[model samples]
Target: MLVSLAIATANQPPNIVFVLADDLGYNDVSYHGSEIQTPNLDKLAIEGVRLENYYVQQVCSPTRSQLLSGRYQIHTGLQHSYIGVAQPNCLPTEIPILPQWLKNVGYATHMVGKWHLGFYKKACLPQNRGFDSFFGYHSGSEDYYTHFRGGYGVSFDDRDHWLGYDFWDNDVPFWSAISNYSVFVFNDRVNQVIDKHNKSKPLFLYLPFQSVHSPLQVPKQYQEPYKNITNNNRRIYAGMTSCMDEAIGNVVEKLKTADLWNNTVFVFSTDNGGQILEGGNNWPLRGWKASYWEGGLRGVGFVHSDLLPSDVRGTINKQLIHVSDWLPTLVNGVAGYPLNYTNLDGFNMWDIINSNKTSPRKELLHNIDPWPYQPKDFNTNMTSAIRVGDWKLLTGTPGANNGQWIAPPGSGITPHLPLTIPGQNVWLFNITADPYEEMELSEKYPTVVKTLLAKLDTYYKDSVPVRYPDDSDQANPALHNGTWAPWE
Candidate 1:
C-alpha cells in the first residue's frame, strides 16, 4: 500500500531520471575525494542525499542484472559476462523488467543510452521490455568516433554490417550519425527525449552513459585541459570524466529550464567499480573492478527526488543498500507497481531515504563465478562472498581477485593441467579501520573465521550457481554447489 500525505496537490506521480556511468569509481567524483570538477553532481549531493555505503556486484552484467531484475546475478542465470549473443542471453524475457512495471502505472518510460543486457530480436528490444522510447547501442562498448565496433580504433566492421542495423528507437530503425563525439551525441539525444515529453505526464528517463570506459579516446579539447596531470593513462581518463561531468551539468540545466527539477527524481550511479589499471584510480581502497574488496564493488550513489523530506533534503546516508533495492524503491515511490514477486535480494530504503535512519540488512551479499574461465585452487579465484559488519571474507585473495578466476589455457577439460601461482592468501579485514586489505587479521581470530566460513557455506548451499561446478567448485563444494535449487 502507498503512504498518503495530507497535502493533496495533484495525483501526478513524480518523474524519475536514472543516470548511470560506466567505470566511475567511488571516490573519483569531485564530491567524494577526487580533484575532478563536477559541480552539478556536487550540487545534487548538497541538495539531496548521498549514499556512501551502497554496494553492487563485481562486474557489469551482475550489477545490471540486479538493477533490472531486483535479484542477484546467479538467480537469473547471468553469473558471468554474457559475451556472445546466445541462449539464456542477456536478461531473461520471462522475468519482468523495471520499465515494464513503470509503464503499467501509466508513466512514460524512455531510455537514451546503453542496453547491453539482451536483444535477441525485435521482441526482445527496449520497446517490448517496457520502455516506450530508446536510442543507443545494443551491444557493449563502441568506438566514440565511428560507433562502429570496438572500444578503440579496432573495428569489427569486416564481420558485421554497421550501417545496415545501426541505431534503434522504440523497436524501429532510428537515424545513425557516426561522429568523433559519441558522448555528446548521447547526451543531446537524452535532452531531446526530455524536451519532447516534458509537457506530458510523469516521465522516466534511463540514461546509461559510456564515457569513462575503455578505448582511451577523448576529444582533443577535453583532453588538453588535463595535460598537467602528468600520467598519460590518467590524463586521457580525466578528460573523459570531466566531459561526462559537463554532460551531466547540461542535463540538469535542461531539467531546471523546464521547471522539472523539484518535481523529478534524479539518480546518479555507476555500473561497477573503477578500472584502476586502465585509467581509473580507486585510491585508499585495495582492489579494482573485479575484486571482492571494498574498492571492487563500491560505487557512488546520489538520489535527488521531490518526495524527500524537508529535513533530509540535503543529507547523507551511510546505510548499506544494494543495486537490487532501486527497483522496489522506484516502484514504491514513483511507479506504484505491484510487488507480488519474491526472491528480490534488496530491501526498500524508502523510510531510510526519507529519515536518514538505520537500515535492516544485517549483512550485504557479494558473489561471482569461480575460475572466471580457468580453474584454480582455493576457489577464491571463483565464487560468491559475504560482507558482515565491516569484515569481508572471500575464498581467495581480495587484491588478486579480479572477479574472475584464471587457469592455464585448455586446462578445464583435462585434470592433469599444471597449477598457476597463488596470488594472495585467504583472510579477513576490518574495513572500517583499514579500508584497504593491506592488514590481515585472519590468524589472530580463528573463531571469527570459522563462523564467517560457516555462514558463507550456508549461503552457497542455498544459492543456485549460475554456472557448472568445475575444479574450483569441486575444491569448495557447499550445499547447493552446482545445484539448481532456489532459496527456501
Candidate 2:
C-alpha cells in the first residue's frame, strides 16, 4: 500500500519513471502495424494499459512544456513553435514545474536525455528546476555520436556555424561521451542512477530520449535488421527506433534487478508525430508532425505499473487523455498529495487510468499557433484548433493532404501518393465518428463550428503573448566555450 503524503510512513509512494520519445509516429511501432519492430515497447504496452485516444501537441517543446507545467502553451506563451537552439526564451521559471513539485514531496529526481524546454539562464536549467542530477542536451536535436549541434547560424553571426558539443552533466558541459552513441550513454547512466538509488525513498526519473528523431543515425548493428528496407531514410529511422526500444528494455531490467520495478509507474509517450519527409510515416492518420491533423496531435502512449487495478491491466483505455494531465494526476490523484497548486489546465486523470472511470476532461485546446502553415511547403494559413467532446474544429489549413500514406520501405506500396481532401481554412469534424477526419463538416454543422470558435476566442483572450524570438547571436555555443550553456 502506498503511504499518504500527509503523514511520513514506512510504505513509500510509487516511483515514477516517465520516458518520452522524440518524433515517434502512431504507425512507427509494430503494435500499430508498422514495419519497424519495437519488441520491448510492444511487450510492455501489452502488459499495461494502452492509451488509444491519447493526444499531444504537434511539435516538441509545446508538448514538453505542457507536460511539465500542467498548463497549456497559451498560458506559458509557448504557443508558437519549439524552443530554438539559439533562442533566448525558456519555459517561464515563475511557473512551478513538475520536478520541483515531486522533489518537494521527497522524491529523488534524476533527468537523462533531452531538455529542450529552455536553457537561456542558469535558473532555467534542469538542476535549478528541482532535478538533483541532470544528464543530457539542452538544445532540441544534435548529432548522435559527435554530440555536436550544427545550424545555429549564430556561429560568429555568420549564419553557418561549426558544430559544437551539446552533452552535459548537470549544469556543466560533458565531453567524455563525445563520438559515443547518445542512446547507449543515456542507457548506461540510467542504470547507474537506478543501481545507486535508495530503495527507502521514492524516485522520479524523467528521461526524454533523443531517439527516433533525426540525424537518422544509429549504431550499424541496430540497422542490420532493417537492411531489407529499401528506402534509406526509413531503414535508418527504423534502426534508431529499435535502438531506443532496447534502451527501454534495459531500463526495465535494471529496475527489476534493483527491486524497484514493483513500485514504479512506467509511462512512455512521444513528443509529437513523426516527420514523414525524414522517413516517418503516420499512415491512415492524416498529417505528419508540425501540422494540425490528427496524425500530428494524436500521440502514442501507454502506462505500466503494478499499481493499476488488475482487471484493467492489459486492456485499452479510450479516455480523452492529453499530455498536460500528468502533473495533477501524479500529485493529487496517485501520490495522494494535496492540491497545493492551482490554476492548472490539466485534470487529475489518475482515476481514469487506474479505475477506468470516465475522464473528467471534456475539452482540450490543442494549440493557437500564430505562424502561417502548410506541411508540404510553406504557405500562410492560421492553425488555431480545439476539441470539445465529440467535436473538433480547425481554423485554417489542417495540412493532411500532402503525399498521404507514406508507407515503410518495401511494403509493396508506392510513395508520395496525395490525399484528396481539399484545402479549407475552417473545418469541423465529429472526431468520434471520424477518427481519421475523413470528412470535414464546418458547412454542415455551422452552429458547432461557431460555438467552438467562440470557445477558442475565450482561450485566446486569456493567453499570454507568444514568446518566440529570433535566434540570438549571443546564444552561439561558440560564445559559451563551444557547448550549449546558459549565457544570461
Candidate 3:
C-alpha cells in the first residue's frame, strides 16, 4: 500500500500555462533577432527549451482547432479557412477537445483571450466546448477599444454595418471597457484566475493574447520605447509587441508570487506566421500569413518547467512539432503515461523534449486544399504539401491569390523582395538544405519526389472532405446578407 501511494504521488501533474500570441512574426520577438524588445519572451527562451521548427496551419481557425483536438484541421471540418463573424459553422460537437481531456484527470481548465474557431451559436462558444471559463472575443479581429467587428459589405450608417461588441466574460457580455490596454486587461484577468483557483486541483490556463494583430493600438508608454524606429507602422507594431511582453512579465511575476512558478509547465507560441500587411515581419523566411511557404507555417515557440530535464533547459530543440502535438504532449506529460489516443495526427513529444533528442515525428502532412473557400468565380484547385525527413513537396500554388503587401504604410518595404516565383504546379525542396527554398530539385530527384507524392496522396485520401462555411446556404440571413446580429 505504501509503494502504491508513492507511485500515485509521483504521478501527480504540474500546473500548465499556455500563452499563444496572435499573428506574431518569426523574427518579431527579440530573441529571434528582431529589433523589437521582448525581454520577457527572451527570458522565457533563455530559461526554457526553444522549439526551432514548430509548424501550424497557414491560417488561424484551422490551427486553433488542431491545437485543441490533437487532430488535423482537415479531419475536423476546419479545412483551410476561418469562421467568419456570425457564420453558422464551427468545430463539430462530436470531437473531444483538450480541456475536456485535462478535466477528466482532475485539472481545472480555463481559457482567456481570442476564440476564433466559432461563435455563431452558444454551442460553438468556448464555455460549451469544454473550457470551464472563457474571457475574450470570438471573431477573427475586432477593434481593440470599441470591441466591435466592423461589418462586411455595408456602410457605417447601415444597421448591419457593425457587429455588436464582442468582449465576453464566460457567456456574459463584457460591456464596460477598462481604461487599460486590452493586453493589460487580459493579463489582469489571468492573474485573478491564477490567484483564485483552488489549490487542490492542478490548473490549465490557456491565454491566447490578441496582441500585435490588426488595428495597431498601444498605450503611449509602450510606444515611448520604440521612438528610434523611423517607420510609423513598425514603431506601433513594436510597441504592441512590447506591451504584450510586459503583460507576460507581470503574469509570470504573479505566478511567482503565488508560489506556482517553478511547479508550472509553461508554453509560449504563436498561432501562425505574421501578417505582413499588419507590420509583421518574417525576415529570412519566404512568405507571410496565408502562404504555405516556410514563413507562413513556421512559428516561434518555447516550453519551460521544473519538470523539464535540467540538461535540456535553455537549449534549442530542432524538433518538427505541429500545433496538434500540444494536446497529446501536455496530456501525456501531466498524466505521466502515454495516452496513445486513436486517430490523432499528433505525436506525444514529451520524451523527445525531456531527453533533448530528435523528435520521433519523422514525417508531417503539413496542409491540404488550403484555399477551398475561394469564391465560385475564382479558380481554385487542390493545394497541398507534405514534409518527409528534410524533403518537402508542394502541389499547386499555395498563395497565388494572396495579395502582394509586405509591410504597412510608412515601412518603406517592397512586397516579396528578391522575388522568385515557383512554377505553377509541383515544387520540391530539401527544406533542411534550403531553408529559404532558394533551390528546386524536383526534376533532379524524381524518385524522392515520387515517394513524397505517394505519401501526400495517402494523406489526401485519409483526410475528410473540405467544407466551405462561407458557401453554406444555411447561413443565418444576417450573415448571408452581410449584417451583424449577435442575437441571431
Candidate 4:
C-alpha cells in the first residue's frame, strides 16, 4: 500500500528515528503534570500524535527485545528480567530482527545508546545485529558520566565489585570517547551519523538513551533549575530529564539542518514505566516498574511526522498499541512491505498513527513468567498479565510495590483507588474504565477472568522457556582486562 506510505521528499521510504527513554514515568513529564521540564518531548506529543494508551514491557530488555524482534517476549524466551552484563543469555540471534528487516529494504540501520539485549558474544552486539554502525554501551545500567558499568568483582560473587568503562565505537572498545556526560557523547554521535549519512537512502536510527535510568547523575547546571525540589532523587532526575529534552531538541534541529526533517518520522517511547524509588512517579496508576499495574506497563509515547494528515495531527490517540507491533508497523506499513511473508505479534500501526483509524490490537499477553506448578493459575500460566478487550487479568506474585499507588513526595495527592484486594495474586481490571486500576474486579467478572486465563495458558503453550541465565565470572571486568566485553 504505497498510497498509505508517506510521499516523503525524494520519493524514498521515510527516515524512521525511534528514541527510547529508560525507565521514564507516565507522569514524570511536565506535560503530564510532573515538574520535569521536557519541551522537546512535549512538543512532539503536542504537535504530533500523543499516544495516551501505549503499552510496553515492565522492564528494559523485554521491551527492547519485543520492539526489535517484533514478537512477544514468550516467543523469544526473554520473559524474565533484563539481560544483565554477566547473564549468559541474550535475545536469540537466529530470528529475524527489526534492523535486519529494514536493511533488507535498502534502509541504513544504525543504533546508538544502550544495548541491553545481550553481549556475551559478538553476534549479540548491535553492529552484528544488523546495524551499519553502533556507538553505545553493552550493559543495562552504568555511570552516565564515568561510563563504568558495575558488575560482580568475580564472576561468581554476584556483588557490585568490578567497575569498567563501557563505551564502544562498534565491536571494538573505545575508552577515549571524550571525558564528558553520555547525553552529550551520544547526542553528538547521532548528529554525526546524520551529518555523514547518504541522504539518498532511508535511515533507521534506534536511539536508546542512557538518561533517566539510575545512578542519578547530571551536570550541576542542568540540576540548578530544580533548586526548589527537596527530594535528592527527584532533583537529579529532573536534571537528567532536562538534559535529555535538550538533546532531543538539538537532534530535531540537526535533522532540519541536514534537510531530513521533511521526510523523517520520529517516534519516542519509554522502555517501561518509571521506577518510583528512583525519582520517578507514575501517579494515580498503581505500583511502579516491574509490576502489572498500569503505572508499570502504560508508556509515554508519541509520533511526529509531516506524513500525518493535518486534521489528525496534534491529537490524542487512545488506540491500543503495543511495543511488539513496531516490527510489522515499520516493515509492512512505513516501508510498504507486504505482511504475508511474516508472522508478527506487532501490527502495522501506521493507520492508527497516521490515518486515525481504529487499532487492530484488542488482546495482549503481557507476560508468562517461569512457573513449574501451574495447576491453580486459572488453569493457565502463573506470574503473568493479559488483556482481552477491556479486561486485564493479573495473576501470581507481582513482586515489588504490590497494589501500592505511591504518590511522589509533596505531590499532595491522596489516591482513592481502593488498595484492598482478595489476595496478593489474581487481580482483574477493566483498564478501559479504570486506567488507574482503582478497584479489583476478579470476583465481579469471573467469566472474563476465565477466558483471559485460558488465553494466557494457550500463549504459554506456544512460549519457549525463559532464557535468563545467571551471571558468569566471564562477564567480570577483571577477566576482560577491566572491561565488560564479550567472553562467550
Candidate 5:
C-alpha cells in the first residue's frame, strides 16, 4: 500500500493547460447566451470557476505580452499595438516569460498554434523564448486552409504567395503538402503532444487556437450546424467557433484517456474581447476590439481542476482578474519561484479562486496609449481608460460610433471618436450601475473623476513609450513581396 501510494503521489504537481481563443467575444460562447453553441466551454464553466470580470488588453499582442511576462505591456516594449510580421518590434528578451519560469521548475513546456508576438528574427521565435517545442503560424492571421497570410495583394494562385506560408515546426518552415483546416490541424498537434507527454513529469501546454479570427474559415461539417443562421459572416463565424469548441472537447477527452484529467489545471480564455468587424458581438457593451471599453477589455474566462476546493467549483468568481495574473497563478500552482524578478503587474489569485473569496485586486489600469495601428488617413489618438472600484474614467475621446456591423476588408472603421466634453474633456461612469457606459457622471462627481485622473497620470508617467508606431512604412516591402525575411 505504501509503495502504491508513492507511485500515485509521484505525479502530484498538476499539469497546466492554458487554452486561448483568438478574438472570441463575451457573447460568443453559449454559456454567455450567444446563439453559437460552445458546449465544451459551458461544461468547463459548470465544472469549474467562471470569472465574470476577467480583463485583458484591447488587442492581441499586448494581452499576449502581459500574459507571458506578468508585466504591463507598456513595460514589455509592446505598449500600443500588435507586432507586424516584418516589423522589428518584439517582446523584449530581457524580461522573463511564463514558459521560461515553468521550464526552470522541471516542467516540459510546449506551444501549439498562433505565435503572433514576433517573427522578424529567429531570436524572437517561440522556441527561443523558452518553449521546448513550437508548432504554428507566426503572423497575426493566416488562411485556415492554405496556411498563408491573406489580403497582402498576394493571390493563392501566384507562386510568389507560397513564400508567405507561415506554418512552422520549431523555427523550421512546415511546407508539407498536408491541406487541412488550421483549427483541426492545431488540435491534432495538441493531441499528439498530450499523447506523448511524460507521465512522470509535469506538462505545461499553451494552446492558443487561431479560431474565430479574420478570414473566417471552417470545414463543411462544422458549418452545417449553423446553417439556420441567415447572415453570411455571422454564420461563418459561428461555424469557426463551433469548430474550436469541438477541438476543446477532443482535448478534454484526450486528458481523460491519459488519466491526466484530475491532475491537470485547465484555463480557457480569449486574448481580448470580440472584433466587431469580424462578426464578433460584444453587444450591449460599449466598444469593439481596439477600444478601451469593457466590450474590448473584458474577456470570458474560466478555470477548472480537481485540485480546486469543492465549494469553489461551479461558482461564479467576480474577481477583477487581469491577463497578467495567469503567469503568477500558474507559477505558484506548480510551486515554482522566479529568480531576480520582483515587480509584476499581475496578482496571484489562487487563494481567492480556490476559496470563493472576493478578489484582492480593486483597480485596473486598462490602457494608456494612442489608437493602435489604424490607417494613416484615419489615424486618431484614442482615449485612455482606468477603472477603480465601480468608477471608470476615460481621457481624450471615447471613440464610440455606430457603423457597419460586418465591416468590409480594409474599410478602416475608426471606433473611437473624440466625445465632446464641456470643460473636463473626460468621460466618467459608474460601471456597476451602467455597464453599457450610457451615462457620464463626471459632472455629478467631480472629486471621483479628479481622483481617477490623478491615478491615470501616475501610470502615464511610468508607462514606456511605444516601441514601434503602427502606421510605419517599414512593413511595406514584406507586404509587396508577400513574405517576411529577417534580413529585409
Candidate 6:
C-alpha cells in the first residue's frame, strides 16, 4: 500500500518540460501519418493526452509573446515579428513572462534554443525578460552553415559593443562553429542545464529546437533512418525531425535516470503549424504557417501530469485552447500559485482538461501584421481576424488565395485611418463548420460581422502595432524582401 501511494505521488506536479519544434507540420510525425519515425513524440502521444485542437499565432514572435506572457500579441506590444532593432521590438517588460512567474513559485527556469521575441540590446532579450539561463540566438532564424542571414543577422548588439556572434549563454558570448549541428549542440546544453538543477525543486524547461526550419541540415544518423522514403523533401524533413525526437528522448531519459519523470509535467508542442509547402505536412488542414488557417495555428499539444484525473491519460482533448493559456494554466494548476495577472485573453483549461468537458471557447482572436517583404501578393498583411466558437471572421485581405490578397466588398481600410497606422486588415469566417475557411460568409451575417469588427476595433485601439525602424529595410538585409527572418 505504501509503495502504491509512493507511485501515485510520484506522478504529481511533474517537472514541466515544454519542447517546441521549429516549423514542424501536422502530419510530419508517424502517428499523424508522416513517413517520419518520431518515436519520442509518438511515445508521448501514446502514453499521454494529445490535444487535437490546440492553436497558436501564425508566426514565431507573436506566438512566442503569447506563450510567454499568457496574453494576446496585441497586449504585449509584439503583434508583428521583431525585425532586428526596428522601432521598439521584442516583448515589453510590462508583461509577466512565464519563467518569472514560475520562478516566483521556486521553479528553476531554463530556456534553450531560439529566443526570437526581440533583438535589441539589454531591453528585450530572454535573459533580461525572465529566463534564468538562455542558450541560443536572439533572432528569428539563423543560417545553418555561415551562421548569418535568416531572421536574425550575423551579429547581435550587446549593450556595450555590438556582439559579433549571435549565440550567447545568458549575456556571455558563446560560440559554436558547428553550424550544421546547432540543434544537436543546443540539445546537449539543455541536458547540461537539466542535470544542474536541484532534483527536489520543480523546473520549467523551455526547449525550442531550431530544427526542420530552413537551411535544412540533419546529422547523417538521423538521415539514414529515413532513407527508405523516396521523396527527397519528405526524407530530409523526416531526418531532421527524427533527430530532434532523439534529442527529446535523450532529455526524457535524463529525467528518468534522475528520478524526476514522475514529478514533472511535460508539455510538447510546436510554435505554430508546420510549413505545408516545404515538406511540411499539415494534412487534412488548410493553410500553412503564415496564413490564418487551421494548419498554421493549430498544433500538436500534449500535457502529461499525474495530478490530472486518471481518465485524462491517453485521452484526446478538443478544447479551443491557445498558447496564451499556458502561463495561467501552469500557475493555477501546477505551481499552486495565484496569478492576478489581468488583461489576459486566455483561460485556464484545467477544468475542461480534468472533466473532459466539451466546453468550446466563446471566442478567440488571430491578428497578424502584413509581412510586407513577402511579395505582396504571396503574403498577408495587417489582418484582424476573430474565431467565435466555430465561426471565424477575417477583415482585410484574406491572404489565403495562394498568397493573393482577397478583398471582400466593403472590407477596405477605414478611410480615416492611414494605411501606415497598422492593424487595419480585417475578415471573418464560420470556422467550426468550415475550418478550412474556403467560404467567406461575411456578407450574409452583417450583424455578427459588425459585432466582431467592433471587438477588433477596441483591441486595436488598445494595442500598438510593432513599428518598423525607419531604417529597418536597410539595416536588416532579410527585411529587404522574401528572405525568412533568421535569429541572429
For model 6 the local lDDT of residue 371 reads 38
lDDT tens readout by residue for model 5, 171-232: 56676614788877888888899889998788899999989898887887877987777767
What global local distance difference test value does model 1 have? Answer: 0.68
List, residue by residue over 1-488, the lDDT tens digit for candidate 4: 35645444545789999999999999789889888889888988899999998899999999999999999988898887777777887889998889998898899999999989888898988899899999999886778777887763235555567777788999777777746899999998998999899987999999999988998989899999999989899989999999999999999999999988878889999999899889988887887898877888999999999887898899999999999988898888888766665557888898888877999998888888864543432342368998888989988876555668878767777765446545556889889998888767888888987888778878878877777666787777778888889998
Query: Would you estimate the TM-scores of all the predictions?
Result: 0.83, 0.94, 0.89, 0.96, 0.88, 0.82
Clashes of 2: 1
* 54-81 per-residue lDDT for model 2 (tens digits): 9999999999999999999989989887
The true-structure Cα RMSD of candidate 3 reads: 4.3
* lDDT against the true structure, each candidate: 0.68, 0.84, 0.76, 0.84, 0.76, 0.67
Candidate 5: global Cα-lDDT? 0.76
* Cα misplacement distance, residue 364 of candidate 2 (Å): 0.8
lDDT of 2: 0.84
Candidate 6, residues 313-354, lDDT tens digits: the string is: 888888788888887777766665777867777777666766
Report the lDDT of model 4 for residue 105: 83
Steric clash pairs (candidate 5): 399-416, 399-417
lDDT of 5 at 333: 39
Q: Sort every candidate by TM-score, greatest first.
A: 4, 2, 3, 5, 1, 6
Worst 10 residues of 1 by lDDT: 468-477
- Supply every candidate's count of residue pairs whose N, Cα or C atoms clash at under 3 angstroms: 8, 1, 0, 2, 2, 35
